[model samples]
Target: MHYDVFNGDADGIIALLQLRLAEPKSAQLVTGVKRDIQLLDSLNLNSQDSLTVLDISMSSNQQGLANALQAGADVFYVDHHKAGDIPSHANLNAHIDLDAETCTALIVDALLQRRFHLWAITAAYGDNLLSKADTLALQAGLSQQQAAQLQELGTLINYNGYGEDVEDLHFHPAELFQKLLAYDDPFAVIADKHSPYYILKEAYAVDMTLAQSLVASYQDSQLSVFILPDTSSSRRVSGVYGNWLANQAPNHAHLVLTLNSQQDYTVSLRAPLTNKQGAGELCSQFASGGGREAAGGINHLPKASLELLIQSVSDYYQVTASST
Candidate 1:
């Protein structure tokens, strides 16, 4: 069997979408909510199987990846996250770039020679590479209005991926991917009012409004923290809302913590856009946390550790700002 395993966020979905659109493939789709990155653990592979993995941290799934490679599966992996000591096996073909300004979709765009350039630009926007996406959009000859449309579509798609579970999401990631595959160009989705773009846009507005109303639980010069109540809306908007806060104050690191059923928090951390350097490292200090340089998350963080997390983020960014 051929399995197409990917992260459920916009970057992962769009990266895979571009490849499948260019080279039609029949494969089993494997994905989960944005935080569910250890997707490889669920699969039982064999010599006859082939896997395509995208936009997930390889170090988190290292054991599973090693098992797959040992089983003789031909694996194609692409990502823009922490990849610790990649394996040296012929069956593994890995493309990893940890650049703060680039994402997986852009890497795939280069590979495909911009066959689906517009979609790649949308993914960059969705992934919060704002300036990068804006430059690329300009280079592609897109009007400001057209770029805004793509940016909104990308942000809405990203918002839809933030839910804690598929049930909380407006549409499951796999379902969203299939629906979007019908359009070769992203503009087609925006133009078609009856598409997921419309549904997600409406839902995003509701969730974002709720998020914006809540005052920061803690705020200072170097960092600001917002703790969201335990609700589906909170789950759906946590990550995107964090991004919104980061964009609003590009120099202040923002943290969005959503209360989970276990009385713990699901943490979303965004480094200051001006200093997108230490988020992943700071988050990695927690047991259930890991991500890219600009953004990181902790699946479950104890309430007692909240202050520590905040202090760590503050000190890191403050020191970084001074040194720079």
Candidate 2:
């Protein structure tokens, strides 16, 4: 058996998409909502199985990966997140780049020599590497209008991955990936008015409008905090809204807390774009949190601990901003 395990978000989905398109394959798809990163734990594999893991951090799933290797499964892993000390197992083929400006899709793009360059560009935009995506779009000779379309498409696909469960999404990420497989070109996905792009475009507008109307729960120069309801819309828009807040105030840290059923928050943290240095460290302080420097998240954070999370984020930027 072949397992295609990936994050459900735009970067993860597109990264695997590029590879599968370049070399068609039959694989068992294992994925979940954006927050479901510890995918390896759910796999039941054996010596004959081959696994491809994308866009998820190795450290977060290290134990499961180790077990798989010991069980004789061969693993190919590609990611841009914090990767602790990688294992030296011979069954592992790992490609990890921690550059804040890159995403897994772009990593695969380099491996494929840009056969799906446009999709990589879209993933960059979706990941909120705005300046990098723009530069790549221009270098590819894409018109401004064409670039915007890809950006929108990328953002929408990314948005669909947010919700708490596949039921909360417009299309399950697996189903969405299968739908996207028909169009090797991103433009074709756009040209078909009946595509997921059209549906997500409309849904995004509604959720974005609601998100914009929300007032910050806490705001000062060094940091801003937002607490959103546990609704499906909130889940869908949390990450994108955090990106928007960071862009609106590039020098300030932003925390977006979406209420979860456990009476805790699913936290999304973005370091000041101007000082993208401490988000991963700050988030890693939490049990279920991990990510890169620019953007990070926690699957669950207790309500009583909100103050501590805020203080940590604030102090981090306060010191960095002063030094710089």
Q: How do the residues 1-324 of candidate 2 rate in per-residue lDDT, one tens digit apiece?
A: 999999999999999999999999999999999989999999888999999999999989989999899999999999999998899989999999999889999999999999999999999988988889999999999999999988988989899999888888998999999999888999999999888999999999999999999898998779999999989899999998999899899989999999988878999999888888878878999989988989999988998889999998888888899999
Q: Which pairs clash in the backbone of model 1?
A: none
Model 1 score (lDDT): 0.94
The C-alpha stretches of model 1 lying farther than 4 A from their native spots are none
Candidate 1: deviation at residue 142, Å? 0.5
TM-scores of all candidate predictions against the true structure: 0.99, 0.98
lDDT of each: 0.94, 0.92
Clashes per model (N, Cα, C within 3 A): 0, 0
